[model samples]
Target: RWSEIDIDNAMWTIPAEREPLPGVKFSHRGSKMRTPHLVPLSKQAVAILTELQTWAGENGLIFTGAHDPRRPISENTVNKALRVMGYDTTQEVCGHGFRAMACSALIESGLWSRDAVERQMSHQERNGVRAAYIHKAEHLEERRLMLQWWADFLDANREKFISPFEYAKINNPLK
Candidate 1:
């Protein structure tokens, strides 16, 4: 929901509950993990969201269904959009495929720790005892920097651009 977005802080908190009406059968819950997901918005993400706000307005929800503004968008929205853009979701990519793209880029960059990446991906801890002790803020600062780097890397190589990894290696071989 748009209410959960703190544009000033550049954070989005996905609550665990969605209560539209009292004792209504049509209420929705947040993440399937039953935990709040706090995502840090990168500069590009913020800029895009800012523009989206202009179109979407400061309404209760940022994205609404095409049929009804009050209803949340369908899960297939991204896939449909990709299809419209001439990308074959089945053969090339799916909505969740972004996770793989980001994970591969981040891991290949050799700039972030595995723990930080896992936490940012919201992966569940295998050990129940260890899971209880984990803090959401763990490596948050590093994650923010990592995300910024990723976005910058993308921007630097949007089109007719060199790979950042190659550029960095050629420019700073000592590292």
Candidate 2:
């Protein structure tokens, strides 16, 4: 039961790379459409997925329960996790907020070009190119690296006191 869904879609039957988006259909190209539609997984995503896979048991569904073997999970589960973490789920604080916070931080950090950052988040870029290309990365590998860095930066700053002033102070102490 859990021996599936290493990478699957809603039904958890097909790899996301091979399956079509739900409720949408086309000719034979439909399934093939998924290939170009993937945002490259970031190193952080990879690491998380890897750990989940291990926790999932052999062939375990990433979202399924081995003992119960039911549907993966729901937003409620996410909300519950938030609540346990003392997050204010009653307010705007929810799971997806991580993306918003990340995008804003990235744009502010200047480590990522605005376009690349949006692509990482699957958000539309400022330029019109985003409308035409959702998952087709013009620079896939570079974007992957940038995404990893973004994740690492967030982790690094999660409980840190260093600020821009500190960085400059350390790097240019003579100044």
Candidate 3:
């Protein structure tokens, strides 16, 4: 999966090959939207990944199973790690839940538009006509800024373990 990351460009191109399919024989297929998802990494993400590169560069995969360097780390692997970190995976959160957390934070930030956030989340438009007209990479620039803001927001609140809304209330009480 690290092969999909382009640290130099601060982007992650989720390959169509990683998408899942119902009837396909191969385990991995393509995206749910049936298109490649290009995620722009924030400055914080780049920094974190830069450090990660040193650890996984030779292996060519960003994360690997503990026993097998050839295999990508499983979702359960992440869940188990989260449990060790004292997070309740069963009720509190799971690996996939991070996306929900990020989406919620992005929405609550009020710095990004709904369309930008939706596009960034790779959510498919239910309206076929609108979907046909909308650009696949719509609001990319804004999405990049939103992602950076999110990472910064997380960094700022990590020590306090407060929600962005709560942090804003304390720091910018009048706003």
Candidate 4:
């Protein structure tokens, strides 16, 4: 929602508890982990949001349904778009596949730490004992740099494709 976006700071805070819209019945709306997720936006993301702000309605939603302005877009929206673009949603790629693809790409790049990537992905530790032992580190600064790198990588490969391994080898700032 627009309320979550902090364009000036290039951040988006996904709240742990969100009040329902008027006439809606949901008690809470938030991340699956029920923890606030901080997303460090890249310059490209901020630019897109800046453009979107011009048409933002009083409902405070960034992306609303075509039929109902107060509600979110349908879950099938991205899948439908992929179908229009000649992708087989069943076999090739679905909307959720993007997350897997991103996760895989980031890991393959070897430029970011595992902690930073997992934090950015909002993945909670699956092992109960491990979760108890692990520290709750946000890794905000590293994520900020990583996300910017990701954005630049995407922009660089918009036309000509480059493998994550090759790109990382050339652009690894940690070196």
Which predicted model would earn the best TM-score? Answer: 4
What are the per-residue Cα lDDT tens digits for candidate 4 across 1-175? 8889999999999999898776555625787578899999999999999999999898888988899998877778999999999999999999999888877888899888888888889998788887777648889998998888888889879989998888898888666
| lDDT (10s digit) by residue, model 1, range 1-175 | 7888888988887777765733324446775467887777898888988888887844377887798776667778999999999999999998889888878777766677777777778777878887778755467777877777778777777765655456445433224
Q: Estimated TM-score per prediction?
A: 0.81, 0.60, 0.83, 0.91
Backbone clashes under 3 angstroms, per model:
0, 3, 2, 0
The lDDT per prediction is: 0.74, 0.52, 0.75, 0.87
Worst 10 residues of 4 by lDDT: 20-29
Model 1 C-alpha RMSD to native = 3.7
**Using alpha carbons, what is the TM-score of model 2?**
0.60
- Candidate 3: count of backbone clashes, pairs at least 3 residues apart or interchain: 2
Error of 4 at 87 (Å): 0.9
Q: Report the Cα lDDT for candidate 3.
A: 0.75
| Model 1 poorest 10 in a row by lDDT | 166-175
Tell me which residue pairs clash in candidate 1. Answer: none
Candidate 2 regions exceeding 4 Å error are 1-36, 42-44, 57-60, 65-67, 125-137, 161-175
lDDT per residue for candidate 2 within 54-104, as digits (tens), equals 666443336653344333444367878889988887786887787787677
Residue 80 accuracy (lDDT) in model 1: 95
Q: Which is the leading candidate under lDDT?
A: 4
Candidate 3 residue lDDT tens string, 40-98: 89999999889987788465667766876756566588799899999999899999999
| lDDT at position 58, candidate 4 | 87
